[model samples]
Target: MIKDSPNPPEHLFAVRPNLDTETLLVNASQDLASISDIAVHLAFEVDGAQRNVALGICRMLEGVQLLVNKALDEAYPAT
Candidate 1:
């Protein structure tokens, strides 16, 4: 889990070693952090854990896209 994470994700998910454990950990951590910031009630749990940080992130992203679309629509106002 993230408890074992050493370095952040960007440093690992780049073109080099080709998808290592560290990369996954880093991505997961970032996703969780992002999700936590925007979400209120986290629904899904990853790996049967209490707080599935990764899944929470996915849910948050969905919300973010919706919010972005709403903003776009308001700004455009259907011409």
Candidate 2:
């Protein structure tokens, strides 16, 4: 008989030194915004505690995204 695996293997992530930090921050903010948007949509589909939890998560992500955007702005501001 074959044995079943209970846990998944860990992934090894590569470090990229050449990528721009400002660009990465912008991309991260965009991705998190998308996630938060999805949570907002899901919030409407669920009810009670689950809906509240989703909305709470969405708020937190929005806050983080705002901070990231601020950081990017500070790093590369318009003249």
TM-score, candidate number 1:
0.34
lDDT of model 1 at position 66:
66
lDDT of 1 by residue, 1-78 (tens): 348657657655555567765455455556655665544345342244535665566576766656655554554566
lDDT values of the candidates? Answer: 0.56, 0.88
For model 2 the local lDDT of residue 33 reads 86
Worst 10 residues of 1 by lDDT: 38-47
In candidate 1, which residue ranges exceed 4 Å CA deviation?
A: 1-46
**Alpha-carbon RMSD, each predicted model:** 12.7, 4.7
Q: What is the lDDT, from 0 to 100, of the residue 29 in candidate 2?
A: 84
lDDT score at residue 1, model 2, on the 0-100 scale: 100
User: Highest lDDT, which number?
Assistant: 2
lDDT of 2 by residue, 1-79 (tens): 9786688556557546798987788788889989998999999999999999999999899899989999989998977
